[model samples]
Structures are given as C-alpha cells and as structure tokens.
Target chain A: MALALDGVSVEVTGATLVRELSLTVESGEVLGLVGPNGSGKSTALRCVYRALRPTTGAVLLDGTDLTALSLRDSARSVAAVAQDNHTELDFTVAEVVALGRFPHHQGGGALSEHDRLLCQEAMRRTDITHLADRGVLSLSGGERQRVLIARALAQQPRVLVLDEPTNHLDVRHQLELLSFVRHCGLTALVALHDLNLAAATCDRLAVLCGGTLVAIGPPADVLTPELVQRVFGVRPTVVTHPHTGVPQLLYTLTGENNP
Target chain B: MTLTKTTADHPPARPTRTGLALPVLALSLTLVVSVVAGVALGPTVVPLPDTLRYLGAALTGGTIGADEVSSYSVIWQVRAPRVLLAAVVGAGLSAIGVAVQAMVRNALADPFILGVSSGASVGASAVVSFGLFAGLGVYALSAAAFLGALAASALVYLVARNRTGVAPLRLVLVGVALAHGFQALMSVIVFFAPFGEAARSVLFWLLGSLGSATWGALPIAGAAVVVAVVVLVRSSWSLDVLAMGDETAASLGVDAEALRRTLFLLTAVVTGALVAVSGAVGFVGLVIPHLVRILAGAGHRGVLTIAPLAGAIFLVWVDLAARSLFAPRELPLGVITALIGVPVFVTLLRRRAYLFGGR
Candidate 1:
C-alpha cells in the first residue's frame, strides 16, 4: 500500500513538466501535493496513474516498478480522479461508476453481484445514490465531481491519486470529502490549490515549485512564511487553527496596509 | 439533502437483465416483418401469400407448381438475395458506425468517415471505367475495392500516427483530407473513361445499389458482417472506455492506441466489403447508431445489439422503396435513405434534449 515516486521526471516536446520529483506516501496516509499554477502537481499525479509515463524514473507500488506490472494489475491497485475528465456521451451515474470496476473484469464480462454491490456502495458513500439513474451530463459540476470520486471509490484501489478534485465543490462538501479521504483508510496522494484545506486534511504536505520538490513535511513544518513567500510569491500571515492547531495562512494584498 | 441516508436502510437494487428484453424482441419481430414485406411488395406485385409460399419453398427446398415458376424465380432468385443483402449490409454498416463513432470519439463519425468508402469508390470506378482487375472475373470490383480501402487505411494510420500514438483529432483530420483526395481520384477515373455507359454505371455504384446481390456474394458480405458484429460486441466495454478519452482509457487499463489500431483495421475491411457489394450506401451507418443510442443507452453492448436490427429493418424498407416507389425506373438506395434520414435526423435534433456527448 506504500506509493513512491522515485526521481521521476516528465519531459514533453522539449519542455520538462516535472523534474526529479521524489516523494512517498506511507500506508493509509493522506499526502497533499500543493504548488502554484504550473508547478507540475497535476503532471506528477498523472505519472502515478499511468496517464503519462515518466521520461526518466519510475513510480513504485510497494517497491515494485509500476511499468513492470501489466496495466490491468497496476490499475487494480491505483485509481485516479483526474482533472478535465469529461465525456461527451451521456452515461447514467450508475453506469459511469461501474466503469471503475473495469480492471477487475477486463474481458467485457457482465458485472457480478459483488461488483454491483461495490458500485452501489461507492455511490452511497459519495451521496450520489439518488443520482444513479440520471445522466452525467445533467448533473451540476460538484455533483459530477462527486460522481467521479464515487467512480474512484468503486475501483477499490489500494492507492488513490486525485488532481484538483475539489475544484467545483461547495464548502461543506469540500470539508466532508477531505474528511472522508482522511478517514477512508486508503493511501491517497491529493493535489490541491487551497493551502488551508491542504493543511487541515493532509498528514504531510509536499510542495512543488518550478517542477521540483521545494519542501515536504508535516503541515506546520512545511507552510512557513519564508517558503510560502519564496515559492508562491505571496505575503502570508501564518496562524495556528484554534481547533485543530494546523498551520493556516492569511494572505494580505501586496502594496496594501495590514489591519 | 440525501447525504445522510444510510446504506443499511436503503439497499440499492441490482440492475435487471430483462430491461432490454422487450425492445430487443420488438425489433427482431419488426425485422422479420420487414424482410417479408420487402420481398412481397416490390414492383412485380407478387401476392403476400404467394410470396410467403415462395419463401417457404426456397427455405425448405419444397416443390412449387409449374405454373408458378416465373413468380417463384422473381421472389426467390431476384428479390430474396437483394433483400437479404440489404439486411446484411445494413447490419454491417450500423455495427461499424458504432465502432467508428467510439473510435474517433465523435458523434458525427461513420464507417466511411475514415475514407475507406471513398477509397472503395476509386477502385470500383477504375474497375467499371477501365476494366481493372478483370482477371478476377466476377470478383474484380470487390477485390479492387477492398484493396483500395486497405491502402487508404494504411495511409491514414501511417500519416496520423507518431511516437505518442494516434490522437483522435489527428485521425479524423487525416481521414477527411484523404477522403476528399480519393473522391477526386474517382472523378478523374470516371472522366477519362471511353464509354458513357461506364460513367452511368459508376454513378449508380457511387450512390449505392443492391442490384447485383447474388447467392455467391451474400455469404461473403454476411460472413464479414457476422465477424465484425461479434468482434465489436465483445469489445463493447473497451469501446465505452475508449470513448471517454485516451487518458481515461489508459488509466483504466485499456490501451487506446492498440484498440484504435484494431478498430481502424476492422472497420476498414468490413466497410470495404460492404461497399464492394452494395456501393457507398449512405445514412444507415451515420444515423442508425445514434438512433439506437437514443432508444437504448450509450453503453456499447446495448447500442451494438439494437443498432444492427434497427438498421436491417430500416434498409429493408428503404431498398424496397427505392425499387418500388418510382416503379420501372428504380432509384438509388442512398437517394431514398437521404430523403428519409435527413428529415428524421433534423427532427431528432430539434425535438430532443439530446446532446451528442455534450453541448
């Protein structure tokens, strides 16, 4: 259940999207990948899900090189909730979620009773059971995102990779989703732009800047003002949350007086 | 609002297999009725009972009265082959349409979208205008057309493919460009032909007809269609995954490139075989799959199963109308299909809240 990216680099058309990015998420741990725009958080996550192969290094599942395993085997262990995952055809929510069980039955076999139960369970957990018969095209963005998350949950993968999964979620759903991930007992690597939520949710934060890992540690140790100012080009007032004692950032506009 | 509902209180119901039974049974019965009507109601005015008797005699190898010989020949030898060919080609085109649409991830895509039919047109025109491949005797046109289709498919695959693999957009663009090029080539061949009759025949072939359907030709087209349908039905899940996009397909352990490659080859060959027998029959391939998807869901298994039956029924009637609507002067099958298909397609677009994948 341990997921490791060992010195992974991705170069596309003469541009290096990610460079020597090494990180590891221990079993059942929630690791947050945070960075400014274009810092390669999405690209790094793509490598873990095998959407894009690393140009140099490898992604390992418990010390086994991912590329060495068959794609079905690798997919059986790692499921992804990728950004921009859109479909033109109108599939009902249940049918879309059932696609998560694809690796378990690769030969276009009919879904077993167990597989159907898993799909139903996934939809229930994501609060999308009511939308099971509705077309995905008809859902609101947040609902669609939850449907996708439900699909990943239906995959029953040991390690989950999510890229910007909270893009369209409301505040309550965002908190609920994060809390679910934290307590779900699955090793997860999440890419997030919301630093506060990342701090509140993740056990460890890995910050990337310019396609390289700039910092990696617990939220309190990694979210220092110097690191935030240097990497994100922001002036931050770091404060401890009164309830959870996690580091939270209150940013001020540049060239403005602080109250 | 329903977020707090517990799984224990409301257990999800399993999907019932019988959901598709009624529609499938309805379509199958409709197809059978259409075939009978296709043979009975042609220009010769054969009575329904007589037509049924002829069909029964032919099927069971029973003896017919001597006085009914000519009518029996008209029903069994002429009308039957053409009607069956219409059904087979219709099924094949519909099956390939589903594959092609999923292959390119475009709702507008059809079996001929990859230029295979245009390529077949070029070869068929050459055979008609210049008697090319005459050594193959009766099979010259089909052989030439199949070769041309294969050649065009190879050209498209090679040009569109790169180290990263074939992207759907690139495949479509390359296919459309090559299709136009092949059309131009066919026109050139038609222009240079010495006889006007050759030009007329090529024109008829281009618009499509089941006029030449024979027992000899039926098995080939039927076999090709059967193989293609089986293969496509088996790959139904893969097709659904592939239609979502290559990246999604890859993440789910389906290799998009390999699947596309196999589909391109399969569709090309089957399309070539179909066009070789029936000419470039239009509309059936483009419209039937969407029609099926609207009635059924977008799942490939359901779409594939129903599309073929619907298409067979549609074409059986269309072909009958082509030969009978104008009486002695038979019309091209494509002309009738377009006349019917365009209006229906436009109405579907206008009336339904359907999005071809999305808005």
Candidate 2:
C-alpha cells in the first residue's frame, strides 16, 4: 500500500500547525517524522490518523482519498497509538486487547475464534501475553504503552500510526518496540524525538520544520549533521553503524571551545 | 483462570470484597423489612398479619378484607405505589448516575446534573399551566415531563458535541449552562401560574415525590428501568474501555463517539421516565453509585447490578420516612433521600483514597 499526504496543511483556531506538507510511505516501509517541539511533526501525523482534518490537501491510502472512506472503514484500515494514553477505567489486558475487534463486531456479537486468535497473536507479538489478565490500571507506564501498541496491532490494519509511542517506555522496551515495528509486515508512520532511534529504524526519514516538509529521503541523505544542526539547533557527530550502514547522529552540548 | 503475573501491575490490590451475593441479599432483605415497616407505621396502623394478609390477597388475587378496606386501600393503592415509585425512581437515577459519572469521568456528576430533572419539571409546569392534556386527562403532566427531559438532554448534547468528540468536561459545562437556562424558564412560569394548580404542581415536582404515584405511571417507570438495565448490562464491557477515555477507546475500535452518545441518551431517557413517575427524587443517583463503586470496583457489570439494588432498597426506607415521619401526611421523597444519602456519601468519601480512571 502507498500512503501519501498530498499537500497537507492543518490549521487550528486561525493558526497553522502544519502547512503544505507532503510525504509518502510505501508498502512494508517505515517512515520516520522527526522535528523539535512545535514543529508540526505530531500535527501532520494527526491529520493522517483522521484525528484532525486538514485545512487544505488530502491523505491518500492506495490511491483512495482517505476522506472518501467512512470513519469506521478508515479506522479498520488504519490504527493509531497516540501519546495521550491516559484512561480512567480499569480493564484487564486481555479485555483491552479484545477491544481491537470492535470495528468488526456489532451488538450482542462475540468475537469469533479467528478474532480471539488474532488478539492473542497481537499480545504475544508485544510480549504481553503474560500480562493478559492484569488490570491496565495497575500496569506501569511502559507496560501500558506496549499494551496500547498491542491493541493497535490487534486492529490488523494495513497501516499503523504511532505518535510518540515510546514516550514513557524504558530504553530497552523503546528499542524493542521500534525494531518490532520495523520487522512487522505493515506500512508505519512514526513520530520520534530520538534522532538515533529514528535513523536506525526508519527506511526513509522525513524532517519536518515549522509545519513543512523540510527534507525527505533515506536517513543518510536527510539526517546530515548540518540538517540536524539546522532543524534541531544542536551540534551532533554523525556516524554510521558498523554492520548496517545506517547513519546515526550522536548529540553533544557545544561549549565555549567546541566550535 | 488466574491472571499470570510475576509483577503486580497495580501493587495495591483493589478491594474486591464487594460482590453480588451479599449486597443483593442485603438489598432483598432490606426491601422486605422496609416495605413491611412502611406498611405497619403509616397513619391508622394495621396489625402485621393483616398487612401481610392484605398483601397476600393482592398477590393471590383474593377478595379485599372489610376491616382491611381503608387500611389495605391506603397501603396498596395510595401508599404502596408511591413507595414503589420511590424505589423505581431511585433505581433509575442511581443507575444513570453511575453511567454518567463513568461516561464523563467525573466523580461529582449525578444523573440530574445534566438538566434532565429540571427539564422534566419545566415540562410538567408547562403542561399544568397551559392545560395541554386536560382534554385527554390521563397523563398530561407526566407526558410533558418525559418529553421535556429528553429534549433538554438532547439539546445539551448537541451544543457540547464537536468534530473532535464530546469530551466529558465539555458535556458537563454545557449541561450546567442548559440546566440553569431551564430552571430560569421554569421560575418565570412558576411566577405566572396560579398557586393552587399550576404553580403548586411545579413546587411538588421540584421537591420530587412518589406521593403522586398512580397505576397509570407504573408501566412507564417499569419500561424505562428495564430498558436501561438491559442496554447497560449488554454494553458493560464497553463501559470499562470508555472510562479509559476516547483516545484509547478509538484505538481499540470501540466507536467511542457513538458509545458516548448512546449512553448519554440512555441515561436521559431513564431519568425522564423516573422523573415522570416519581418527580425529582435526588441524592440516590448521586450516592448509591459511589457506594457501589467503592465496594464492587468500577467495573460496570458489578456497578449496574449493584447500584440499582442498593438504590431501590435505600429509597424504600427513605420513602418510609417520608410517609411515617409525620402522621397523616407525607414529606417529599427527595428531602429524605438527601438527608440519608448525603451523610452516607460523605462517610464513604472519607473511607478510601477514591481515585478515578486508569493509571
């Protein structure tokens, strides 16, 4: 599937959060959106997830305009794990995972055997099958975040959108979650604050600055030290992985004699 | 099956002692005892067996006793429906209270806080003042109140809902504004209508009464409660996810928007039906749900079943107080519920940490 934001612009209260931005994620490819705070990175993803409508432009999934699809149909097509994961109700992990089948099940209808298997498969993929019966209210932040991702995975959507999914996760789970996303046979759009993690997991990188697509290409081409300095306002040493050949930037605070 | 976990997610184990058997048994026993006491303590007291005999006659479809005529008539026809109406209204209010509080994720929210009761009152007052159903003369006031209740909540929902979703905070804010508007309009009507019929009718409604219960009102209250209970029980699973907030619910594909709207309307209709039959009985909806939440955990399965039972039992006695606290007359049911529920609620509030929502 081809995912494209064609000339996307988002405005809230007469102010533009993201403007005239466009990018694409090919089938089975992972595209990373990286930018500093307030740069429209999350806003652009929000437009794609149908959380916020665009002021102008449109999102297309496999050549079909996303707007043309009903919200439920689009929901079945794309699943989201957003940063706002706070919940007031206490549901067991298995119950939470089972909710991913809601788009398919109507009133008084139980999940089919196939749906149950999918829920278990998704939970196992997230390494959360052990916590299946645990109350979500009692889980730590990192564990709950994984559960959210697992819930999205259970949706079995062709495309997955994650906005800062790793925000509350620990270092190890963060790496594991991203690497797992990369290995999953699905198109993924991810917003990340960590440049190194983005470079490592992303097949292609799109740098967002001031609500616009400043640069889009492979990590090597788009994440130069100069680009990092220009967009993130931080001086970073650029290096390549010893075996994988992916460009990774290591950041450091510049001091009096640093330049 | 036991939940497998080396590490407890929430180390502080939830107090799960609040279960079905005890609370239900307690409620059933309370209803029996309360109803009996209510019959025994009313004006022109009858013996216990006589009371039972009269009730049994009603149950077994036997002839009405002569000595038990005024006493039995007063107990069954005049007073029993009134008491049952209290229980019915209380059950509906408390159930709606639990649902709405869970829906909006607010602890302080009661069913009527959404303008349902006052809206009913306004409608009741309008019908009385204008004589809408004087020709039909059957259910003029109640029909008006039910319609009014539905219209007010629907209006509040429409005003609050936006493209993003109907956030609980927005819904409550809109509800408060709309309720004030309804009450203001009601006040103006009260000022104009005559004190004997129109204005006095509105006053009785404001105080909330089971005193007005008639055989006519029974079916409406029964249908509403039955529908509310069925719809809520069927959707108990969703209520758990809903408490988690919209983002998580949508992510799970629970159709968060649709669920919110559906539950909101359900609660409104339930409230309208209760208000129509029993007037504006308050405090039960606000109190019983919290009590159940504390005991049974916030799971909707336990809450829906337990809150209604608790409310129904509690109101049976509260209505008894309304009837027997002064001889030969009855106080408003709302006053008794507030008096009983408020103290119990405060005490319960002090008992636990009382946090709401998923961590």
Candidate 3:
C-alpha cells in the first residue's frame, strides 16, 4: 500500500518533535529513515502508526486519512515493529504470532483454520518455527527480534513500519533480517541507525536533521560525503560495496584525527 | 550470544480445547464437593445421606416430611444462602481482580485497590452510626456502600488521569493515596459514633462478615457477577492484548484507552456490589488471579474462566472453616483469608520462579 505523510508535524508540550515532514513510500518499496539520536525518526514513525497524532497535517494510507479509520481497520492495513516491543509476560512464540490475527477476529470467534495456517507460515518465514512452543523471554535478543518480526508478518499487512528493528541483532542476524524485509515485497518504512546498512537495504533514504527533512532520494544520492559530514558532524568516506555496488560509509572521528 | 537453532522433531501440538476443559471440569467438581461438604459438616453434623436428600428435595422444589424439619431449616434457610453468597462474592472478586490488573496494566491491582473498599466502609459506617439513607429501608446500607465505592473510583479516575491518559504508575500511586485518605475518614466517623452498639456494628462491618447473607441479597450479587463475567469472557482477547502494553494493543486495533475506561467502570460496579454485601473480603481478590495465572497461562479467557471456579471452591472451604473451626463463634472471613492466603502466596513465590507461561 502507498503511504504518504503530508506536512505532518508533532508538538508535545510546546516543543516540536517532528516538523512539517512530507514523504511518501510507493507501493512495494523500502524507504529507510535515518537521523541522529534525537532527529525525530521515531517521532515521525509514531505518527504513521497512530501512537501519536500529528499536531498538523495528515498521514494517508492509500489516499484515506489514517485518523478517520478505526484503529482495527487501519491495523489491518499496517503492522508495526516498534522500538519497545518487549514482553514482560512469557507467551509462547505461536501465541505471540497469533496475536497478529487479533484485528481480523474483533467480533470474538475462535481462530479459524486459515488464521492458524497464516501464523504457522509467518513463523516459518521468520525461521522461528522451531521455537514455536518456547517462552519468548527465554530466547536470545536476536531470536526475540525475529519472533516480533514474525508477528508483524502474520498480520499480512500491506504497509509495514519498523523502528530500529536491528538494535538487538548481531551482524549476521541484522543482515538476514534486513534481507527478509527487502524480499518480503511489502511497502516498508524502517528507521536505521547504521547508515551503511540503510544504504545497502533501502531502495530510498530520507535523512532528517533536527526534526526537518534534509535530503530524500535514492540511497546513492542521499548519502553523499558532503551531506554526511554536514549533518552528522563527522568526516565520512563513501565506498561502493564490492558485490552490491551500493554506497557504504566509513566514518572517522574528526577531532582525534585532526589532533 | 550462543544461538543454536533447534532442529529436533517437534511434538504434535497440544489440543487447546482439552487444556481449558480439564481445569474447568476439575474446579467445577471441587466446587460441588465443597458446597456439599459445607452444608453437611456444619456444627449440627447432619449425615451425608440425609444432607443429600434434603439438598435434592430443596432443589427440586419438594418438601420433606415433618421429621426432617430441623434439617430442612438448617440447610435451606441458613447454610444454602450463606454458601451461595460466598460463591458469588468469591467469583466476583477473582474475576474483577483480572479485570483491574489488566485495566491498570499492573499485576498488583485488585478489586479494592482503587479505594472502593475504604469508600464502602465510609458509607457503611455512616449508615450504621447516623442512619444515613434510612429511607431506603432494607437496601439502605448496601445502596450507600455501592454509591460510595463507585464515587471513590470515579474520583480516582478524575484525579489520576493526565492530559494523555492514566499512566499505570500514576494510577497506582493515586489510588493508594486516596485509599489511605478514605480509610482515615472512616476511622474518624467510627470514633465519634453516637452509640456503643453503632460503633460495634461499624467495627464488625469493617473487619468483614457474611453474617448478613440472606436470600434477598444473594440474587443481586449473583446477577451482577454473571453479567460481569459474561462481559469479561467476551472481551477476553482484548484483555490479553491490553496486558502487553497500550501501544501494542493499539497497533493490534484495540482502542486501549476506551477499553481500559470501560473495564474500570464495569469492575467498579461489580466490586461495589461485592463490597456492599461482603465488607471487602480481602485476599481472595489479590491472590486468586495470580494463582490461576500460574496454573493456566496468562490468556484472559483461560485465567478469567478458571479463576472464578477456583475462587468459588476456595471461598466455600474458607467460609466453612470460619464458621465451624470454633463452633458457635464465627470468625470474620477476612481474617481467615489472610491467615490462609499469605502462606500459600509466599510458598508459590518461593517454589521455583517459573514464568506465567511455563512449559
């Protein structure tokens, strides 16, 4: 599904967290949101997922206003892997994945055969089918992250929103997870702290600096050395990956190198 | 991190239908046994055979012969209503415990955590001492207590909520503070009661009792619990999602704030009705849900269904012990609950820290 943010702005207690941001992810594309620690990537994502209402402008899913739809209907269209998707209670992996079918069963019926199959398929796709009966809290960080991703997949959403999904992953798991996201064929909006991974994984990149959108385009154009140095305040050397030919950045500490 | 993927052949999935049915059946059977034992083994020690005959006749709307007059009155008029009230109050408390815990997103919340009990105490004390709402005649005390409980919960909601919503921590802190405030107020009213008999009655009500259990009041509490349990069971999935967290629940298409608010009011009414009649029988609400969650998974459907049955069986035995342990002198139900509940709760906590969804 196509997702558009039209001048969406979020103000919490007289402070603007996201300012007049307008961006669009076309159907079946991976759009990466990259920024410094507090540059409002998460804030913008929150507005899309309806965790917070935009102070101004709107979020549209396929030309319909998101706020106008019931949360259940909107959830059917969009699924999210949020930053704080940690479970205190220990639900089995299957049970966690089955919760994704919740929006479909709002009228209160047992899970149908189709729903159960969908959950099994989601677990298999995320490669956690073996852990189906295991308690979520017993899993390693990477395993837990994959379980959450499986849950999002079980929703069978048209649009996906992920906030820092790679935070808990090792380097190998990180690549596998992003590869799955890339091949899943869903329109996705993902926030990434690792610029090299973002450049490698995203079809397009939107860079934010201090609540404003600074650059947005194909990854090669968006990750230019000048823009990186200016926005990130660090000297960056960009190199093309040997296999994929995507632009990858190697950063140097400016003060240490100069001294 | 050492991550070894499991490649062992997975066992066939357990049938969900049988899982829920077995526990429910066991608990239901236990409840039946408790009721029979409770009625038969009281101070009078009626034989089991005669007790069953009397129960069978009473249930079928038949009368016994003149020789069974004493047994008839003892079973039908006295023990039956009291035992049924215990069952109703037990089921209500346990179910409401699940609702309140999920509503506030905290494991510590119970039916009375939001000051409902203390508020009920204030109202009951006023009625006992100053003849407040005496015009309502038979319902005056219960009516005042229910109103006070509801009012206190409403006040807690109004006070604890911020611009966004009631954050769980704030709700806990606000509820505890207001509960203390209400308790102090109850104490002040009891201290200056105009008569010694009024003070004694107020004290008795504060400690809790089922002595007021009557055929007239049983149906009201029973009807309230039935309605509340039906509503809770229907929304069980929503409760499961809500317990995860607000944002996750919203992402799953549940309006978390709206659901929480609805549960708050529903629990208030059910708990208000319970406290009005039973005077805040304490540990049943606090301990029973946790025990159920330990035995069953944290799924609301399973926990909510089984907790009521478990609670009913538990309270029947507790009430039995209260009435018969020191024959002719009855113990307050609250005293017996804490006396039993504390030890069991501590043992469970120390008995290997298995997660709620254990293998």
lDDT of 2 by residue, B246-282 (tens): 7655544455778888889898888888888777887
On DockQ, the candidate that comes out on top is 3
Predictions in order: lDDT: 0.89, 0.80, 0.86
DockQ of 2: 0.35
lDDT (Cα, tens digit) per residue for candidate 3, span B1-359: 99898754433333333468877888888898888888888778888988888988988977789988988889878888888889999999999998988887676788898889988988998898788999999788899899989999899889999899878678778889999999888878888888878777877776678877889999899999999999999999888777667777777888888898889889889999999988889889889998876556567888889999988888888889888999898888888999999998888866734464323
**Per-residue CA lDDT of candidate 1, range B237-355, in tens?**
98888877777777788888899999988998899899989998998999999887766667888999889999999999999999998888889999999999989977877765565
Residue B339, candidate 2: Cα error in Å is 3.8
Consecutive 10-residue window with the lowest summed lDDT within model 2 chain A: A250-259
Q: Which candidate is the best by lDDT?
A: 1
Model 3, runs deviating above 4 Å: B1-17, B196-203, B356-359
Residue A245 CA error for candidate 2 (Å)?
A: 4.9
Position A13, candidate 2: lDDT: 80
DockQ of each: 0.41, 0.35, 0.45
User: Which TM-score values does chain B get in all models?
Assistant: 0.93, 0.90, 0.91
**Superior candidate under DockQ, 1 versus 2:** 1
Task: Please give, for residues A1-259, the per-residue lDDT of candidate 2 as tens digits.
Answer: 5799999988888888998998889998999999999999888877777766688999999988887876557778788887776666555677677777766665545668999999999999988988876667778777888788888888888899999878878899899899888898789999999988999999999998888889999999998888888998888888898998998877665564564
Cα displacement (Å) at residue B115, model 3: 1.2
Candidate 2 residue runs with Cα over 4 Å from true position: A2-22, A53-70, A111-134, A170-173, A183-186, A241-245, A252-255, B1-11, B14-56, B122-144, B147-151, B158-167, B184-204, B346-354
